[model samples]
Target: MNTIVDFQQFNNATLEQVRTRFEEEFGVMTYFMNPAPRPCFNKICMSELHQSQTSLEKMQGEVIANGKVSQANYLVLASDIPGIFNLGGDLSVFGDLIRAKARDHLLAYAKLCVNNVWTFYNMQAPVTTISLVQGQAMGGGFEAALAAHIMVAEKSALMGLPEVLFNLFPGMGALSFLSRKIGMPAAEKMVRSGKIYTGEELYQLGVVDVLAEDGQGQYALNNWIKKNHRSLNSFQAINRAKQRVNPLTIEELYDITEIWVDAALRLDERNLKVMERLVRAQNSKVNSDVAHIQEKQSA
Candidate 1:
């Protein structure tokens, strides 16, 4: 039973938030995330998540097609934007929804996040999933990175859970993933501390699988792949065994999300004000970057 993955769609399809590159030589399919406006997990990224899953599903049991063993063994998730992996959720949307007292909308959004991140955590495909963090990955973004089977981060990359700053919590999959990677006590401390940590610090804490030098994230991952090429089966199997020993079910994610939505709905004006400020900062930075990129292109 073989389902041949069609990479042509990713090559030419009108995907706005993600750019796909198929490394045929290594059975690798890397998707570069570039969620626009702020590089956050916005609505567009949600849709793109589904698209990526669809492609991955097609890669299941993909052994040989057209007389070639083109089975994709690794799927690496990367960021197309420099200096920013993702800033987390759409704060602007959060402010608006919270103000409107839209619990259902907020819950829906959180569930969408849970569903998507869960796929990255448990791809269901034979291929191993990797998160290559090159820059800042905050809140939900950090949670997403934690969901990967392998998290390879650049030593200089900055990551944190800043939900507490605005009187909230990272409710998607942070606690679940972090608890499994490190421990509950450490994960709880991280969630409550609201601290930003460098990739080196995370590697020391055993949260990061592999730590690479600054600006050499891809190189590090390539080297790791080569080193483990012969033992990829054992590597992937170990990841699966770890999950069996301590599983993280989608039901638990949904339960946590409900708590998050309740807390979000209860936020006062002051809390929203804090979120608004962050949103403004994100907008200003993104606009400035866009302008700079445009200037460079035209020059």
Candidate 2:
């Protein structure tokens, strides 16, 4: 019972976009996202979101069989992909679909993303969700991290929304969550500016809840868990209260994401070209990460 066991031990959730690990010592379940094919949010990653949700629900049911809701006090999100949390949406797919004028496909993708984000932000279980950012979290990636109740980031981590670079915007709960942290005006400025904020900067901006030294993100997350678990009940109550006072609804995220899909559909050829370049850059990173892993294994 004192040993850390993976949730996969109970429910063998497949890992295409994400992997699962649980520390029974702290009752913390972590989903380490590693979006496959190109380290970006693709269809597989979206489906994996549901897979993760189901896995967590099952875990919750198992632990709550004793009628204790606080048994699972934390769910953490991290990344298995080296040096990159996520590069955001699958730009290649977006470009191809946009060029084909596939509004339905785009809307479908957006809706799925919003739904998952909403679930993470509003988990039904009495658990505190966290994001541990040790690498780059761009566009939808940053939004994904923001979806958590708390974010523990390495100070050197880089994060931002670069959708504006392609004449679009991050529509999946970025503004809603960010506005909750730092006013609406600041959120709007961040979205428009497309500036890549370091973890330290975001901590200063009140976006990052906990900041750790470089390469110590996981350590910081555990330290935080230790510090907060004693007061978990009260803290959770405060979090719930905040939700009541400044609520974020699924409908709100859906509406904004729909607008993003429409804007993407409206992008000129010039904008599509930018997205294409971004995809290429993402591919390069994936390739580099693979090679690095291979080199290490060989060595």
- Best-matching candidate per lDDT: 1
For candidate 2, write residues 1-299 as lDDT tens digits: 33333444445655556665655667877777777787778888877776676556656523422223325568787888878887788889899889999999999988888877787888877778898998899988899899999999999999999989988989998999999999999999999999999999999999999999999998899899998888988988999999999999998998898888888989999999999888888888888879999999999
Q: How big is the positional error of residue 90 in model 1, measured in Å on the Cα after superposition?
A: 0.5
Q: lDDT for every model? A: 0.86, 0.83
RMSD of each: 3.4, 2.9
Q: Give the residue spans of candidate 2 off by over 4 A.
A: 1-13, 58-70
Residue 147: error of model 2 in Å?
Answer: 0.9
Q: Which parts of model 1 have CA positions greater than 4 angstroms off?
A: 1-13, 61-69, 294-299
- Candidate 1, residues 60-114, lDDT tens digits: the string is 8253444565667887888998788889999999999999999999999999999
Instruction: In model 1, state the lDDT of residue 153.
Output: 100
TM-score, each model? 0.92, 0.92
